[model samples]
Target: MFFLKIRSIGCAILLSICGQSAWAFHKDVYEPRVPNEILAQEQQVKSPHPVTPERIEAGRRVYFGVGFCVTCHSKDGTGVNLPGHPPRDFTDAKWQKLRTDGELMWVLKNGSPGTGMPIRVGTDITEEDGWNVIQFIRTFGGK
Candidate 1:
């Protein structure tokens, strides 16, 4: 009878601890921690979807095939780790919110210099293909 009571008490304590932890934690969505004053100074811009079905498809093929986007961007374009650069969470709307279309276009066209991402397939890739790939990238959203 004493053993049963001890076991019951232990189980209740475990459940309580688990319950507290579950409630306290949440997956942090990607939002740039920019100051409100800076945000106020910045201009708002929208990224127009410049991709067509055919181009987007071609880009997808390139991304999954020769472009080797899967290595860094992951198979789903989630932006996995390589070395120096922290992978961009494509699903993060907050991260996406910070970049303009032009900025993203430029990054796609000329890969970031300091980061592990280098100019590779994009040099040969047409502008239309880049746009398509960017559009495809935009689709990954947090559920």
Candidate 2:
């Protein structure tokens, strides 16, 4: 009976921690990942590359290939739920509208804080590839 009580308490504590963390992730879905100091400038920044079918296709390749974006964002861009925080749901129209290509690039270059996203551009992909991937991500918004 004592052991059962201890186990129950442990389980309850674990559940509370997990629940709070999940809530935290969902609560900040629309919050800017970029730091406030540079967010405005970043938002104003535009992709040098034009949006063409070819570039979008190339971006798709980067997302699924070297960028390894598919691992977290998933095939459908709905994102996969990981342990600490759920990945961004690219299918979210509001989120797509809220984020800019340059801001996305910033996240790619500098991984999002308090999340699983790692520095991707300089590490695995190039700056151009990052821009291309942003174009590809915009497709998820159906834009």
Candidate 3:
């Protein structure tokens, strides 16, 4: 009886470890990608450029061109299947509502942790292009 109990406990431990590793591969979609230290301040930041048709068009050009966002996110913004963690689904209304432009900009400037995302604003695109692309992203959610 004691041996059976020990075996059960061992199995539980193994399951727990496996579960944690699986969870580590994909981050919670709703969880803020921003670090907690500056999340509040970052959330408050706003885009200097207002949403406009011209700006959205410009953003589209960047997304399809220099941004290289299409390679991973796909043309429809549904995101492609990736190895570690799947890219975010921009079409999700809930996710669109929860995220702010500032937070998106932060992600552009600083690659999201624990995922495949990499920095793009400073390296590939200008800050203005980042904000414009954010506006274009919002369109996927019909916002």
Which one wins on TM-score?
3
Q: How many clashing residue pairs appear in each of the predictions shown?
A: 0, 0, 0
**Higher lDDT: candidate 1 or 3?**
3
lDDT of 2 by residue, 1-143 (tens): 99999999999989878766766657588989889999999999898988999999999999999999999999999998887778888888999888888889999999976577899999999999998899999998853
Displacement of residue 45 (Cα, Å) in model 1 is 9.9
Candidate 2 residue spans exceeding 4 A from truth: 1-27
Q: Estimate each model's TM-score.
A: 0.57, 0.80, 0.82
Report clash pairs, candidate 3: none
lDDT per residue as tens, model 3, 16-92: 66654565565588989999999999999999998899999999999999999999999999999987678899999
Candidate 3 off by > 4 Å: 1-23
**Model 1: residues >4 Å from true position, as ranges?**
1-52, 120-122
Question: What lDDT does candidate 2 reach at residue 121?
Answer: 92
Give per-residue CA lDDT, model 1, range 20-133, as digits (tens). 444334323333222346433332423455556776677677677666776778876567754444557777777776655555666665564334555653475666666667
